[model samples]
Target chain A: MNVKIDGKYYSGNKGETLLELARRNEIEIPSLCYKEGFEGLGRCRLCLVEVIEGNSTKTVSSCVYPIRDGIEVLTNTKNIVNMRKDIIFLLLLRTPNNGYIRKLAEEYGVKAPSRYLDMEREEDCILCGLCVKACEKLGTNAISLVNRGITKKVSTPYDDASKDCIGCGACAEVCPTNAISLVEQDGKRIIWNKTFDLISCTRCGKCYSTEEVLHHIDEQLGVKTQEYLCESCSRRLVGEKFKEAFQNLI
Target chain B: MAKGIVISPDKCTGCRICELACSFIKNDSFNPKDSAIAVLPYDSVGLQVPMTCLQCDDPHCMTVCTVGAITKDPKTGVVKVDDEKCIGCKMCVSACPFGNMTYSSRHEGVVKCDLCDGEPQCVKLCPSDAIEYKELDGPLNKRKNIANLFSDVFGEVAE
Candidate 1:
């Protein structure tokens, strides 16, 4: 199928979305909550683009909309710029201190929108659905969207402890505004701390947060009497022990 | 007709997303050890070089494979391993120039990039457009352009 994006005719595959086609053609479109190889959640509305010749010519999410034949797509029009600026402004008013979000807003020259109502909560949850997708798709249901619209949150049910949480920290990793954090507690357990550090292993170069090491024996290795090592280290240690054991047995 | 992956160093921000995506797509988890793509970071220089299967025309890995498991895809020009025919040899792993090919612990066979069937997920997910899918000749020009753009943006590359 042929699609005209910014007056350039391109061949698009059947059932391919407009966003995917645009990306394949090297068209730049800003997206926050869209992750490739996963289900599309059009919550952020950051990837809004104008379909110039199609019936849906208004600002529509390119990520979710499939590419139709002969459709004219304008990715960086003045209206899209204005809408993105306004959306960023409103998001900034809700979340003021996020460095990532603030930087994105600054890139678009957006200031905080005026407060519409007094409806503000202690916690900031823009409901981007990254946490939910990370849980459901990744086979670790550590979080989910609770409550109905206007009250929905990417949270655990009843704010209780998650039984199936593998603590992969994918939820916190994907959060755009740093709303979720996996916290390490006194080398015993992990909890949601709202502050996170994307720590990497010094030895093997694996990515893990500080909270992931919370219940790990390595967390108490230095302080405690018994030394705890990671899987690779422990394997070497175990090999040495087995060698000694075999000699003793002989 | 061998296909190779070209990485633009100037565009790379050392995010290691390519490594993660490679591992996830191949291994079904986020373990970099299983990933065929390797990102080597030089902290002193603040630079990262992502190395992977080049699928060279005169492929060393295919020549070294004793059981003749490694073969080049005619259509995509990507080197792929016939896992069913593989004998779990380490010759191909040793023959790799970039040290990107590896023996999969799960499969007990050598694994490398198949370019994700020519629709590489890493190229799609890269935030800075650092990684791009193009013909072998096209990627070099693209990298040169990106380096010029980077030099213009950052003033000068650090020595």
Candidate 2:
């Protein structure tokens, strides 16, 4: 199906979202919560676009809006620009110190927030829930967005060290504002208030994974390896076997 | 039914040719670490066990996937992961019981044996005929008979 975006017709496949098609065609659509390969949440309204019908235009979040034949979309109209500015202004107020949010606010021409009444509420998290979504998708479900309204924030159950968390760092990797803190120090990984011992390759002496994650892999997969070599070292070990096998030919 | 790779650990010489072939064909590199099939060696017993995905009738990876990215095709019986739909969450990596699911750091996604599109490279390259791709009905039936016999022996003892 062909859909018009910014007056240009772009062909898209069935079940393709407007934002996905736009992104495939190299049209920039800024979105905070919508990630590729995951279902679109439409929580962050940054990718809102105006869909034009007969004598009427309806604003929709393009990330979750599926495209149909002959649908015309205007991405950066005056109304959408104003609405995006408002969203960015609100984000700026919530995450006053986040560099990513500040950059978005600056791009949308939102100046420094004048209201200083809630300085104590200043935080770095935008509460976009990307980290929570990533954790759930990984089947761990270790972290979630807890609380309600203004108090809502992502945390482990009871804000304690999660027993289910394997210290894989998927949540930290998916956080848009880098709010999830996962630090490595002294051969241990600290995340969600839990410290996990890092496992180093027996051959290369490079820390590759954590002990808890390896144990989790063992429990689920039911296959155990004798050695603790990293991927590169293991590959090299396999190469040595190949060398020994074809020694006569070489 | 679909053909699957079967390994005979006794026949394996531990040369690691199957790993080289699989990794080179699938990843365009000669890295055994990236191979879908793994050859584990036990020096004490002098045994080499080649492990790969069984593509089970009810795959745990498919059931635990939150985004419905992993699916087993009914016609081909090939369990596959859709790269376009996968979120690099590693859910399937932990769900597999046989340690067959692999998460590639280079590609940033989980990958597993797709039977090499029905011609398993490891089966072809195995020098000792340790790995074979064929219908598993005979082996499965024989294993079921042995299991029944063991259950009979243990059931009487328990009673």
Candidate 3:
């Protein structure tokens, strides 16, 4: 499909959203709730754009909005910029410590805190839903939005150690606020409420897989292997087997 | 996900982070008075229980809204007020069974937990994991884990 973004006509792929098309054309639209891999949530209204379809024009979230032919999208208009500025300001009030939100606020020249600042809650989740979505997509369901209203937060089941968690680290990888982290300490891999015994590579002696993670994987896929080995070592064994077979054939 | 936050009252230590987080997002301040969630600390016994909306299956506040302002979100199962339709009647405030709803003097309207659009902040920042957000089918995860432990150790729940 062909869409006109900022007066520049560009051909977009069939499945690409407006945000993808705009970013591919070097148009950077700020968004907090949209991730490259997941479905567009459209929670954060920062990526609002005025789209003109001949007779009618409406402002929509560029992240979830589809890019189609004859759609003229205005990304950085005066109104859009002001709306983005307002969202950044409110986001700063909620999650001031988040680096991504802070940098966006700085770039938009939001120097002073909003009068909503007589008091504040110090948290870094940003309510972005990236981590929660990532965790759910990983099929662990370990972390979710817990409680209601401002008490809402990302946490494990019953706020206790997650028995279903596989320690995949996908949630941490996609988190924009850096609120979650996977750390190895004392031969154990820990994230949230679950801890696993780190398994060292057979050849390189480097810790790679956690015991709980491997067990969870086995439970999910019915794998019965007992030996603990890293990715490279397993690859090396396969490669060595291939080499031996080739030599015998020769 | 239509989920609810389950609190393990025994684990609470009165840090009040849930209260701070609640008020900050709701009123843009950390004052617990404005928070929808509260940490009720038993001063004599030194016990704290964080309380908020239960997302009841049949909410009294929703039924009592004369102007039809209070409505339940089908997606998240959270009961919310339609501000434009709300006449600030405070009828739902009195109808709430748990008293989680409140009348805000500054805003001149009744306020309650809307589940923060399904991303509650209090559950996110609870240090002791006293609060948990999950679906209704399998809410008490910790209790289930304990039951499993007991089965493992004692070999049966009952004869």
Candidate 4:
């Protein structure tokens, strides 16, 4: 199907979303919550588009808007640009120190905060849900949104050690604002303030995976975890064992 | 892309984006109230579960439909509600064991998942693969009980 985006016609598939279509045509629309090959959600209003169908026109999220034939979509209009600026201004209030939000705001010439809108500087978590979603997608729902409204923050249950947390570090990897901190302390890795004990390789004595991570893996794969060796050591041992078995059989 | 949706409660993060996507796709607006899917959040236990139409082989909704408005697809085995034929009696809604069926205030009729004609919006929009659309190899069914009411909003977790 052909979708008219910014007065230019772009070819898209039957099930393509406006975000996917615009991105294919090299159209620039800033989105924080969208990731490649993963589904887009109701969060992140950055990819708004003015969808015009003849006499009717309304702004809709391009990230979730299903692309159809003969619909006119404007990526950036004067009114849309102004609206986006306000949204950026609000986001700046939430994650003031974040460079990603600031960099986008800078593109819109939103360099600094106005005197009347001064707020205290804070951490970078914008509550985009990418980290939480990434964790869920990785088969571990360790971290989630805790509390409500302004007090809403990413944390484990009771703000204590999480039993479901496997310490895969997928949450830290996908955080848009670089807010999630995964730190190693006393052989236990702390992710989102949840501590998980790390398992070490027997030969090299190098910590490879968390104990919970190994257990979770074992549960998923329906196999008993025989050894707790790092990837390389395990492979080396397997190779040696195979050679020894062959020699004995020969 | 085999049969129907599969819910893994452990993988759910209670984002409710699945609900948002379902509502928007159905109504062209974002409202969880109009959504076919609902995420029951057990915050005390830090557990989130996505609940929706399980599309059972012998569906209670289909059986209890007084007007015979609900029918199952022969090919995909998806149970669907035909609104044009529906009398709005809400028999199917009450008879539904999973409580997956709901009354849509916007549509003035009962609403349930049609699997989006085989490409479910909930599965497509779920950031976590908690809700998935695949071939059903076994009899994985959902039966609602009194326990669901407490577990959906808030339930205690043993420390």
Judging by DockQ against the true structure, name the best candidate.
2
Task: Give residue A210's lDDT in candidate 4 (0 to 100).
Answer: 74
Candidate 4 lDDT by residue in tens digits, A1-250:
8888888888899988999888777799988888654567747788888999889999998888988888999888998888788888888877777888888888888755466345577678888887776666555677788899888988888888777776767667556677878798677787766777777777798765677666555554445555565543533443333233333333
Candidate 4 lDDT over B1-159, as tens digits, reads: 237787666677888999899999988889887888877665655566576776767776675553456898878888988764554444455344355777764786677889999899889878889888876654442323322533422222100
- Residue-level lDDT of model 1, residues B64-158, one tens digit each, is 55345678877778888876445442445534434456766575656688889888887777787767777654645754564454443223211
Question: Chain A of model 2, TM-score against the native?
Answer: 0.90
The residue-by-residue lDDT of candidate 2 on A133-234, one tens digit each, is 877766678999999998898999999999989888877766778787889988888999888888898888877677666665555545564666555455
Which portions of model 1 show Cα errors greater than 4 Å? Answer: A54-56, A113-124, A192-231, A234-250, B1-159
The DockQ figures for the candidates are: 0.03, 0.09, 0.01, 0.01
What is the descending DockQ order?
2, 1, 4, 3
Q: For each candidate, how many residue pairs have backbone atoms clashing (under 3 Å)?
A: 0, 1, 12, 1
What is the two-chain DockQ of model 3? 0.01
DockQ of structure 4: 0.01
Instruction: Spell out the clash pairs found in candidate 2.
Output: A221-B97
DockQ, candidate 1, comes to 0.03
Q: Isolated chain A: TM-score per model?
A: 0.73, 0.90, 0.83, 0.86
Cα lDDT tens digits for candidate 3, A1-250: 8898888899998878899788768898888777654668887788899999989989999888877887999999999999888888877888777777778888999864456663456677766777777666545577887888878878887878888776756567556677776787877878887887777766788776666555554453344444555533443343333233333333
The segments of candidate 3 whose C-alpha lies over 4 angstroms from its true place after superposition are A13-16, A114-121, A202-205, A216-223, A235-250, B1-159
- Which residue runs of candidate 4 sit more than 4 Å off their true CA positions? A114-120, A238-250, B1-159
